[model samples]
Target: MKVHFIAIGGSVMHQLAIALKRKGYIVTGSDDEIFEPARSNLAAEGLLPVADGWFPEKIHKELNSIILGMHAKADNPELLKAKELGLPIYSFPEYIYQESKDKTRVVVGGSHGKTTTTSMIMNVLKSAGKDFDYLVGARLEGFPQSVNITSAPLIVCEGDEYPASTLEKRPKFHFLFPHIAIITGIAWDHINVFPTFDIYLEQFRIFIDKIEPGGVLIYNHTDLVLKQLVEQHPSSVRKIPYGIPQHRIENGITVVTLEGHSGALKVFGEHNLLNLQAAWLACKELGVGPAAFLKGIMAFGGAAKRLELLARNERLNIYRDFAHAPSKVKATMEAVRRQFPDRKLIAVLELHTYSSLNEQFLSEYHGAMDLADKAVVFYSRHALELKRLPPLSPEKVAAGFGKKDLLVLNEKEDLLKWLMEQSYENVNLLLMSSGNYDGLDVAGFANKVS
Candidate 1:
């Protein structure tokens, strides 16, 4: 197969390119800008473009398909050329569906926990000697690629509700046609795209409708919204609901308790316990029994940046997490507070994404950081400039969060100064952001406090 990808420097796009290359397809791709990690990863796979930027001539009659990335515009030069040539074109999700049509597709969807849940299933399956293909959003410990489209009969995916591409305006999850689906929970998000809470939630409704007939839909019954949605769709699908598994935290380690058996786990927190339960149900559907799933997940540490430990000592620990949305903030803060109840919790988060920086969306964070003993919000003026949004004042941010004691910082140097001055005795520092503290070395910065 001959395939060309537009805006191929994207995190998922580059991985898809490498996966296709591994599948013995003749793959070529282009991007206007290629950033690190994606650039280096593509180069390592020998899939990076010979040169950056689109080449109109690359879209020729011999090209079998063109896969579009969300980064590309509708009138992108290569996209226009491909359309002019009358060749078959697909968005990322459309192409993924094309490859997995014959397989039993299991999609994990929700506002959060999808990546962790998908990783859990992958780990259990891998350890149980099950052959399956997968496309998880985060880079997992055992998986070589974030996406793998192979000949395996079962395929597990972390289904995101974001748009597929400029050409395909539908949510990516709509195209997956899942034979089994899981919705972790629903919280208002993506203000830039969906605009309203109802509109943002309606996407998941559409996703449930798109599942194949007789497919199973597993969900967190603890979430009222998810429970209501599943109840409304009673006959169309079989519903499986799970909550936090029986577990205990002993001396800072979490252990799962099952019937007549108990096993220690590397990952913890209420959110992860819920994630593990959801994953366990999905794995059971795939024929992995409870015993094997527990054994495998016991070895599963965590996916990247979800409460990732950066530096730790006997009394103090520093961790980084990819938590930007309001839901993510609540879960992440709660996790840290619950894990170390006796320690003084200092939480730092960055408002880097368009949604988080918006004044209208700021109120969603009300009480989200209440669990922290000290809460700090950091954002860069340059990031606001690059995103073409208005500069957010510290007063406005503090007021928006409704946290009178919240400290907000805009300058990186000042934040670093504050960090250096802090004492690390009997405290846990949780640095949470989708973007790194504007390129500050978190480990190096954490070490200074230790």
Candidate 2:
């Protein structure tokens, strides 16, 4: 099989290209500019385009399919050429569905925790000697790539609620039609796309409707909105609700309690525990028994950039997370605070995404950072311009978060300088953002502080 990719330098797109290439498919892809990691990884696989930018000449009849990435616009030159030639074209998620149509698809979807939950399932399945293919959003330990395609009978996908591509505005999860699905929880997000809370919510409703008949939905019953949605939905799929399993934190370690069994878990916090329950249910449906699943999960640390530990010392620890949305920011901060109650919590957030930087959406962040003893909000003036968003003043950010003492910084150097001046003793610093602080060396900074 042969496949061509438009705007393949995307995080997921480049990984998919490598996965297909590894599967012995003739994969060719191009992007206007290829960034590091993707550029190097693609080059390593010999799948990197010889030259950057779209080439309409590369769109020919011999290509078996064209996979489009969200990075590409609807009128991308190569995409237009493919449309003109009448070649089979598909958005990333649509193509994933086509490939795994015969398999038992397991999709993990929610506003947050999807990646971690999907990774947990993958970890358990792999450790239990299960043969399966997967497409998780984050790079995980022991996984070669986030996207892996093989002849496995099962395909576990991290089902993102975002639009599939520029041309296909439908949420990506709607295309999976999973036989087994899990919704970790839902909170309002993606303001730039959905615009309103109800519109954003209807997308998940449509996702539940798209599940294959007789499929099982494992949901977080603790989430009131999700609980109501699941109960009211008329879908014929079997519904199983899960909440925070019996667990406790002892000496900074979290222990999960199963029926007649208990074990320490590498991850902590209410959100992660809830994610664990969701993953456990999904794995159970896939034929992994409780004992094996528990044993397998003990080794699971976490997915990249989701409460990832960057540096630690005797008295201080630093964590970085992909948490830009209001709910995620609150949950992440609360988690760290709960784990290290005695420590002085210093939380830093970057308003990098369109939703977080938008002046109108700022109020959604109210009380999100209240858990921290010292809260700092950072936004790059250049980033605001890049998103074409209106200017946000520190006063507006403070009011939005409902934290009177919120310290807001616009320059990376100034933020770093201020952080360096603070003593790290008995401090648990949590850095939260969907993007790095304007390309700040977060790990280096953490190491220096530690």
Candidate 3:
């Protein structure tokens, strides 16, 4: 089959294009601009577009389909050409559904932990010798690509609640119609899309409703809101609730106990523990026993950037996480505090995403970094200008976060200077953002500090 990708420079979209290329499909893509990694990755695959912008001539009636990336606007010229030709056009998730319609679909969805949970299930299934195709949001150990399409009987997906595409205003997860689904928890995010808490919530309701009849839903019971939602949603889908499993921290290592057996883990944190449980239950439904699950999980370091350890030593440690939302910030802070109770923790967060930087949505971060001995918030002034958002004052950020002494920095240089001056003696530093601190060398800094 032939497929074309619009907005091919998107992180996931580019990966999907490569996967389809490997699947013996003729894949072509165009994007207005391409950045590092995606540009280099496509070039390596020989799928890089000859030009930088859209070419309407790239679309034809003979093309099997067009996969629309969320980065593409509704009026994208290549997209318009596909429509004009009456060719099949699909959002990534919609196209995923079309491919996996005959397979047993397992989708992991939440405002947080979806990537980690989905990766864990994928790892465990592979260890159990189960054949499956998968789509996760992060680059992970043991997986070269974030997406893979194969002739496997089952497909596991990281189900995002974000709009599927500019054309399809529905959440991406709604298109999967999973036979087995997992919802880690929900918190308000993407204010640009949903605009309200209730509106944001109704997306998950639609996701739950879309589950194939007789399917199973594994959800976080500790999240009372999610628990209530599950109870209220009347459906034929079987309900299975999971919590943080039996686990303990021994000498900086986390060990999870299952069925009277224990295994030490490379990954730590209670949020990770909850993620592990959801993964275990999902793997169980797929016929993986606890023993096999433990074997696979023990080898799973983590999904990239979700609590990824950058540098460590007997005295100091540093981590980088893709945590920008309020729930994510709070959970990540609490996890670090729990694991290293005696360590002096310094949490530095970069407000990069629209919700994180917005003056209104900032209130949701109240007490998010309260567990840290020192809290620092960073945002690039250039990022604000690019987004066309009004400039935010440190005072407003401090007020919104409800922290009297919150140190807010608007420049990467100031952040770097502040970090360099910190006493790393027995300290654990957590750097959280959805973006690199405006292209700062986070790993180099981590190494120097360590």
Across 1-450, the per-residue lDDT of candidate 1 in tens digits comes to 999999999989999899999999999999999998999999998888889888999899999999999899978999999999999999998999999989999999999999999999999999999989889888798788898988889899989998888977788999999998999999988888899988988898898898899899999999998889778864578888889989989988998975556889988789999999999888888888778988999999899998888888888999889989998899988888888889999999999999999988898998888888888999999889988998788888898888768999998888888888778889999999998778888878877666
As for model 1, its CA RMSD to the true structure in angstroms is 1.2
Question: Model 3 over residues 184-281: C-alpha lDDT tens digits?
Answer: 99999999888999999999888999999999999999999899999999887899999989988899899999988799999999999999999999
lDDT per residue as tens, model 2, 129-241: 99999999988999989999888999999999999999999999999999999998899888889999999999989989988998999999999999999999999999999
Instruction: Give the TM-score ranking, best first.
Output: 2, 3, 1
Clashing pairs in 2: none
- In model 3, how large is the Cα lDDT of residue 187? 96
Candidate 1 weakest ten by summed lDDT: 229-238
What pairs collide in candidate 3? none
Global Cα RMSD, each model: 1.2, 1.0, 1.1
